[model samples]
Target chain A: MMTADERGEIEELLPWHAAGTLDRREAQRVEAALAEDAELARRYQLVREELVHTTHLNETLGAPSVRALEALFAKIDAEPQRRPGTAPGIAMRIGEFFASLSPRALAWSACAAALAILLQAAVIGSILIKEKAPGSYETASVPTSPGTEGTDVLMRFQPQATVSDINRFLETNKLSIARGPSAGGIYRVHVSGAKLSKDEATRVLNTLQQNRIVGFVAITH
Target chain B: MQTNSDEVLIGRIAKGDRLAMQVLYGRHHVQVYRFVLRMVRNETTAEDLISDVFLDVWRQAGKFEGRAAVSTWLLSIARFKALSALRRKPEEELDEDAVGAIEDHADDPEVALAKKDKGAALRTCLSKLSVEHREIVDLVYYHEKSVEEVAKIVGIPEATVKTRMFYARKKLSELLKEQGIDRGWP
Candidate 1:
């Protein structure tokens, strides 16, 4: 008589054996046991039935609607693309490089970075005050700065445009990303240096709209 | 793209290749959707969860170390997302239409027995299984995953996977017996 534990062991392997996922040894064992045990053979038959039923059940569940893929792609388009070479390795290497610096050198570097930030902040504050001065005609634009109060423009890049194409376009236009690619793939690009007058801003917007790389551009007010 | 191995596709996806993402999604999205649908029992939620699952795949493709088959990896992610979704909305009920459909087949023991289509009866019983038991059955039988693969996807020990599979089958047998279709073993 097959021991209870042995029967149980073979019983568990029966499903895998029916599914044909068992390795040779386990398959052989289960087959050998099936030959000897009528009860085990009956259980194996039931496993086969369950396997068939389960397969049919899942097959009937069907595929998700195409809308699922459309939504997925839209989310993907909105997500900021991680550049090819900017894997964790780059961050780790930078970490190692900083770790290798002498304590004194690191402290001096930190101090220099703090001083630079303070100087940039002072310049930005002065520019903001100047923009808001007594007789200045206030523009409806949201004040964002790349070291100075500047007009933020909302622009959508062409889907086919590569990151390099975007970087080159931004450089050529002297615009910096202040925020976004929001859910709509619109970026808030800051025109650096002086804020533009309404006509100059409209002219810049018209120019951006004409570029093949830009699909839409609007002066954010 | 169709011929590229899943690992190769994942490598390309890690580099922000949208075409590769589309290919991988095409290859596996149905299975992932079905798996999540089985767990959540709602089509809309399953559709939403699948989007989240593939989005994770797109974002974390670089983290896939090829220790598991791509299908297994996808199911693992799907399982995690489904379970998290279930937890967040714990009171969410089974899809009434699905339950009604299955019940129509097996709810009346006499009707089930009269139909004499053991396959339909078996399927209705399979649907009646607890989430844990149903998942084990589906992964092993429908997905044809190995014990190790099921363990990895379900995050359980291989031994537990076997026992769970055994119990799931046993429970299924008991369910069949309730429908007056005994297969003669405990």
Candidate 2:
């Protein structure tokens, strides 16, 4: 038998267990208890067996020895027909919302959406196209200097970070705007060119990293 | 009265037969209502919950995945409606007298023996369990939802369902034992 605490737990479990709601751990404990204890098990079975015959609503249905089915259907008919979606007018109105969108607007939206998507895709695609070197540099857009002397770092900006702010940092550090749009969502400045001084790239990358938009940065040779 | 098979009626429901809705509601509503009634332990709330279950079935009948038995799916809906009703309250609970009433309501022999035997005792003792415990068993057995479906419907993790069923069956075992019924069957 379950202790007061155990029984209390068991008591709480009985409803769902009877209703079939117990979580696996609690259920396992209940089962083990039943398996070990005969009285609890017996009570469990008796309740399980009795669940079907209960009729609470039949209090209304019982006495009429007359057409119970008709009475039930009568009740059904009397119910507030909350069948909103089933009505022809309502369903047609919803259908019209789908129908009202002319093919022209949809096609136009699709093309515009696709074009914008492709642009976003291209920016990311170009960035990822290079073979990444572990803790090393792989520049997608060559700097005017074309020298690997400047440290390469990768940075990601926060949502609120603006491309202009990123561009300002790039300009200050002599980092050339690489594959990313200096005008778009994120400005990825590659300070690979000759103008970029030794350790200047790292310092600039670190500065950008502190910026709210620039959430992360990685440095490479 | 012996009811029509859930499988046949369900197929008709899928075909958009309105009468199938009526038949399905007429046949299963009582059990579904009883299940909700036991969990919520209120007559009017149980009725509303029953209607909610049928309304869902009516709207989503075509969406039935047929992954499990129709009765199982119906029970899953019933369990969900009941739980939603249960959650709507601030610290809502089933009172002892209300629960006792459920047990007493089920024990009426005329009602139990209607199809009798295994089904009746299941109802009576089911009321004896706590609202939380009874809810799971009602969904599992009376509604016939599988553990995964029950878990999803109840919005708990899946493992919780097995545990609920374990304790539920233990309770059922005790109830059945009183009637000399052995659930020794697989």
Candidate 3:
């Protein structure tokens, strides 16, 4: 005769046993108990029935819509990329800091940052021009304004390329977004440092074209 | 890439690999959606919560210590989000459509008596279980999770997992008996 505690223990193991998730020893014990005890066998049958019903109930719930994936990617694109090897607490604090800002504040902050970058670029360009010897300058097909003396390449990013991917790509190529993403999802990318000669410009365009993240690239002028 | 183990995919995801994230999402989203749907009961809420769950995955992939299965980690994140969502909308009662649907299955004791489909009756009883009991039942039977995995996902003790499972099964049997489909057990 099975003790009450023994019966309860076997009863608790039955669900896991029916699920095929019990360890071998517990499973063997349950099997042995079932063989010797008709009552335990009946209980195991009920457990199996419950498993079928539960599985059926869950299966009928169906899969999520495509919108779920789309929404997830959209949110990811909006998130600031965490630096590699950054501590979790620091990253979360950074995220929280940005999240705490209002939209207007964020926009104003972005505008101020953009102005700082443009001013710094102008200063750097002037200094480089002053340091160069006359007649040593290479001519490009397109003439740039004094403050904007960089190769302008129009590029389109792949649809699946995220903001982090774009940032990494730009940093590696020493490029910055100079203008519109326009209606066509194209961005005018400014290659920093010296204005490229035609061959150099073509090489840069080719590099962008070959990259996985850039779906299209061309020297706009 | 499709054949990569979940841990491999999670490792890649931790490095900010979009393709890896997409693969992991494809592999698990259906079951995760179903699990959240069972908790939230509204398809729209469940769909939104699925996005939230995976967004957490993308943000926290690096923190996964391999202490639990990837699926268990996902369900844990999903359960936390679902519970928070539930808490935010405490005034929103149980889904009326679902309640009505259950009633439609057996309008009265007389109709329940007339219903001879034990499987259908049992399914109705499963649906009628309290959320706590239903969650435990689904975790064990439907998700086919081990007791340890369920304890991790549910954030309860292993011993508590066993007792909860026993109680959940006992309650399910009682519900079946009430529906006139008793397969005799305490």
Winner on lDDT between 1 and 2 is 1
- Give the clash count for each candidate: 0, 59, 0
lDDT of 1 at B168: 81
Tell me the tens digit of each residue's lDDT in model 3 across A71-184.
999999998886887433344345547878999999999999999999999999998888676766656865555345767888899764668889999999888998878989
lDDT (10s digit) by residue, model 1, range B1-186: 333378778777878889989989999999999999988889999999999999999888767666788899999999999999888874437567445434333346644553498888788778878789989999999889999899999999888899888788788777777777877767
TM-score of each: 0.63, 0.37, 0.64
lDDT of 2 by residue, B1-186 (tens): 232366556545555566977778776666666666666766666666666676666556555555565666776787777777778855436565464544343435543463354455555455566666666665655554555666666778655665765666576565555545566531
Q: Is candidate 2 or candidate 3 better by lDDT?
A: 3
> Per-residue alpha-carbon lDDT of model 1 for A104-155, expressed as tens digits?
9999999999999999999999999998898987655755443347788988
Superior by TM-score: candidate 2 or candidate 3: 3
Per-prediction fnat: 0.71, 0.09, 0.71
Give candidate 2's error at residue B135 in angstroms.
2.1
Model 2 docking tier (incorrect/acceptable/medium/high): incorrect
Compared with the true structure, what per-residue lDDT tens digits does model 2 show for residues A1-221? 45665554454345446655556766787888778777667667544543434332222222212233344455555655444344222333444465678999878877999999999999988776653536657466956553454345555565433457666766675766554433434444565545455567567666766654465666544
